[model samples]
Target: YFIIQTLAAAMILFASTLNAWQTGHWAITYPTCPLTTTIITTAIMMKLGAAPLHLWYPEIMQGATLNTALIISTWQKIAPMSMLYMMHKNLPTTLVLLTGLLSTLIGGWAGLNQTQTRKILAHSSIVHMGWLLIALAMDTALATLTLALYILMTTAMFTSLNTTSTKTITDMGTTWSASPTLLTLSMLTLTSLGGLPPMTGFTPKLLILNDLSMNHLLPLATLIALATLPSLFFYVRMAYMTTLTTPPTTTNTKYT
Candidate 1:
């Protein structure tokens, strides 16, 4: 695939640059340490839509159906996580925390004004990955647990949305009279995506914050928490629009 090849080419280019930068007088030393590893891993993760580089995902997801979006969000996005795990020993803590913090802030802020359902979910995914990146600096056991839980929660939400072909909060709210259960679940899922407790999304967020604090990255941890507030606020707004807002007159309801 073009994407895979492009990624390979990028990796090669990055490696070449690193070699050129860190090379000795006549030879090159492939750097292998926590700081180097973290930088490399974080770069790769950004390439894979890890955090600040996550701007493309929502727009791309919006262009696809639920099935395709699910694949891209789940299986396809795992490449970076796989890379992170493989290079865990060398990952830097400071860079990881910074990436996580920035990702969370940007993602949540960007989602605040979105009206399109897919864009909202796309931004939500970015925020979730931000949390995940933060969690990666924690113990491996916790990271795995967080990832697994994220996959399940996201999958369930997407599956439900796909089943009904729901694309916007208005689409959901107006149709609630037809399927209350779907609307309710969608609300619950939105809140869950925002990292609210009593759902699966909370664990990863808690773990990320806990890990960051333990590592003495308390400021970063606090920023992540603050960032999540925007995510929660926007989703709650969407929920209110979907479940409580009265329908307005529309000559045509077709997506455009």
Candidate 2:
């Protein structure tokens, strides 16, 4: 991890050096320096945990404590995404589009077999970042809205999981007895996270898809929608574990 961070910092420094050399200024907005812009966007993409460069995110989140995991999944995303937003117009459009598509596909595919709740959420974060990237390509306003909504939903999930001390799918199966109300809320939260209709999560995705289609990106939009199915399957599986199973006889009342 230390090596990765160091490499990322070096990439960013190299980009800055290139920008300074070409434009005789240290600012990030160099219209004549496409190479510098590309380098900076590449670094930002890795920082955001976008696909083909996202191998560390799930493992790192898995190793963190719940509070630390929550911070990583939510707050840590802000800096890189904010940078991406600032550079959206200057960055390479094709590269951003490809990164978004691959992240969407890989994030969902990688999480399907994970039992660890934190890793599942980590992958889910990557998937959401993919959507955000797509939206950023179309409209910065919409992307900002998506990012805000994602943070809200993720915070709710992490808080509930922390309260319950849930670590895995099997641990979630026993959550009902501890706090039925929390379990119920978690189901709705997961449903929203899956972008199911009539939920808050569905609203942003619907808008983004419409935008993509209007922009003649129908094929890409269709692919993103299809990729979401795998993620929804896992969300449903987690919901089932939390809500469908009966409480064990040895259930504790401490959380109730």
The local lDDT score (0 to 100) that residue 59 gets in candidate 1 is 73
Candidate 1 has its poorest 10 consecutive residues by lDDT at 24-33
lDDT of each: 0.72, 0.89
Model 1 segments more than 4 A misplaced = 1-5, 12-39, 249-256
Q: How many backbone collisions does model 2 have?
A: 0
RMSD of each: 5.4, 3.9
Best-fitting candidate, measured by lDDT?
A: 2
What are the per-residue Cα lDDT tens digits for candidate 1 across 1-256? 3464366447645654665566533221335433445456646665556566665677787898888888777777677677677666556766776777777888888888887777877787777777777777777778788778778877877887787777877676675665788878877877777777877788777877787788887877788888889999987887787678767776877887
Per-prediction TM-score to the true structure, in the order listed: 0.82, 0.94
> Tens digits of per-residue lDDT for model 2 on 58-176?
99999999899999889988988877876777878888888899999999999999999999999999999899988999999999999999999999999999999999999998788
Candidate 2 clashing pairs? none
Give the poorly placed runs of model 2, Cα more than 4 Å off: 247-256
